[model samples]
Target chain A: MSGIRLVGVLGGMGPAATVDFYGKLVEETAATCDQGHVPVVIWGDPRVPDRSLSLLGGGEDPTPYLRRGVEALKQAGCEVLAVPCNTAHAFVPRLAEEAGLELVSIIEVTAEALAADGVRAAGVLATSGTLHAGLYANALRRYGVAAIEPDEPGQRRVMAAIGAVKSGGVRPAHRRALEEVARSLADRGAERIVTACTELVLAMDGSHVPVPVLDPARLLARRVAGMALGAALTG
Target chain B: MSGIRLVGVLGGMGPAATVDFYGKLVEETAATCDQGHVPVVIWGDPRVPDRSLSLLGGGEDPTPYLRRGVEALKQAGCEVLAVPCNTAHAFVPRLAEEAGLELVSIIEVTAEALAADGVRAAGVLATSGTLHAGLYANALRRYGVAAIEPDEPGQRRVMAAIGAVKSGGVRPAHRRALEEVARSLADRGAERIVTACTELVLAMDGSHVPVPVLDPARLLARRVAGMALGAALTG
Candidate 1:
């Protein structure tokens, strides 16, 4: 309890995305040796019911599983928590209240980053569940930043690309579909595009997009690292 | 209590190596969807006293810290455990007996793999602590395989390359040193070279070696994944 704060990750909303986030967390930390890195405990339960399907009323409730993960982390002596999945954050408010630990919000951190950079309008690329729940939109709206969502056709393509990433691997077609939707969003006055979905973050390369890309997972990783290292808290 | 076994990782011997091991775990799993992947809990405490330093009698004992990690993972409900660090295997015998959980050994898996492939003599590249502890040498000997270690000067280069991977990043000098040692070992009647140290596995590209490279971390990852997924356990 006296050393660096132990960080807990509630992961495996999809196993690959969680690994990606952990890699980013390692990369973001300023460490000169093995001892300089933060301590972390991860409860990566891939068996948690699909967050999107659950939110869309097509799958079992994932709240129980999510709660179980949080409880395990707490029992393991985690001082703070991070959930890497965007759709999973739809349940964060209640989870945070019951978790009794500081839960870093990926959505809040992404919105704050946009607001701090003077972004007035930003395009969001995420799963239908995140969009349906308005997780990013609601967070960004509070900061007076407009969240531009993909149109119905564009969103369908986004979903297809995300699915391709999860099922096997992303194909050229999936990348092209994501690129088209990103351009469409940029055409609709999106100053910057946010890859809110972890799956899209894995599938879409930022260089292919029309505008600058904001990766919420990377942002959240940095925030968590800073907190664990006892650095001044910044958005 | 009766679902898929939760795999626990006793990691953070160095953060990057642990991340590399977890990434390999994800890649080795035959998962078509999120739920298809195995559940995992990782106690990644970078503050665990340096295994190499402690083994050299130059740093604090790491046993207490290692035991603490084991207890935490147990409390978190992990069914099986894996330690990614090669040097840490020196403590595994005692830890396993007390852990009340199945601990997958990187050293044993690597040896078994070599034996299965009909490799008679294998070059082992690892930290000084691992060489000093004879973790790989003893494990290979049990399978009637000869363990070929680097000469004095070559051992120094292996250590330097490992340090380079831990401190900042691998440089050309580090890669060249590793390549030279690998060639020297191959010239000494070695059939295959084992990247026993996790850091060396990260720094050395497999294709650069003259002989086929055996990565123990990858072997352990597949074993842990199989155990969790209820697949038949194989060497």
Candidate 2:
């Protein structure tokens, strides 16, 4: 039997984010030819209920649909699973237990990456659900690092940028708004910032941000490549 | 029952191209929200034998692997299917008949799009496998449009560009090579050009091409969106 590991993506929390995650996965792999990369089976069911709304208390439970996506990927013979959405990760432990599959956590990994890079505190840019759940803060705390988020006005801007990206309407204004948020966080003494929202990552270019930015989607892709290919992750 | 058609992607002919196709599918959909877009299930098995090499007569027959990919998508309940790789279409007729799935033809649809846009003749930038099989020539023949190609040296440059893209090494040299080939074809009286190879499309930017360049990947994505939405094709 071939020893290639198959990575399954439980994606489509937002279709564009899922697509971006897949692109990063390809870019991170150390392959010069098609065969050099790991094999992946993607069950991108955009019908999966909204995770952010569910976590924020006004939407249907996404677990059932998330379960179906996991089952589909498992049936397709995936050895390891990865989810690109940070907010959706609130369901990962339960989903992994139920599916009896190994899941790489984006939050845990991103937080560890921060500590590894000697970052003391970083600004968190994500959905209300992720912030409310303290996903990044809780994870970073494990590594003795602190996670900070935008204040009310800045968060409103971040949310607007995320919304614009999700609707496929990322105008120049959206980019400017996200940049302003990053600059505000930097002025407030944030040495680095984490783009925890996939939509925000799509809309915000790292070169334009005032501070160094860590993208969870890119980190997740790196972790996935490491797990699937048993190699060290590289930029 | 909801009338949303699930688009199945018979992909992983090379994983990057498949991801690009999904991104375009999301972009072309008339969705203002996550639920507004069509549902899609992608089975990206990079294990599928090389189609261009196979058609070029020194690679494994890709039919069995193609059948497996189609069957997987069908079992996952994809109502319509799309194959993003142009050379892979050489197997579509037989695969569709065997799987009883309506497979959208990137080649035929592209040829028709050229005619609809009033392109009298277009340069075909593709792999040796596609040129040798006359895939675009045969399809364009039905539309009464002529197909042009690069000379031997220019064809060599085109091949290098495609290889550079597949290896994720899209150097400036590769871009220049492709641009030179496009200009060469235009000088030969080709009114437009088709980036028939997905890798070629990834390497090229339309602004750099002197003549109008049609991207089959984008055209294929539009067709997939139309089929999934039950909408008539629009120019």
| Displacement of the residue A110 alpha carbon in candidate 1, Å | 0.5
Q: Candidate 2, B106: how far from true, in Å?
A: 0.4
DockQ of each: 0.84, 0.70
* Predicted candidate 1 versus true structure: per-residue lDDT over B11-128, tens digit per residue: 9988888989988988998777888887999899988888988898898899999999998888888879899999999886588669798988898899999999999999999988
Q: For candidate 1, lDDT tens digit of each residue in A50-136?
A: 888878889888999999999898889898999999999988658867979899999999999999999999999999889988898
A28: Cα error in model 2, Å: 0.6
Model 1 vs. true fold: TM = 0.97
Reference-based TM-score of each model: 0.97, 0.93
Q: Candidate 1: deviation at residue B134, Å?
A: 0.6
Model 1: CAPRI class: high
Model 2 misplaced regions, further than 4 Å: A187-189, A207-210, A231-235, B231-235
Could you tell me the lDDT of residue A64 within candidate 2? Answer: 86
Error of 1 at B214 (Å): 0.8
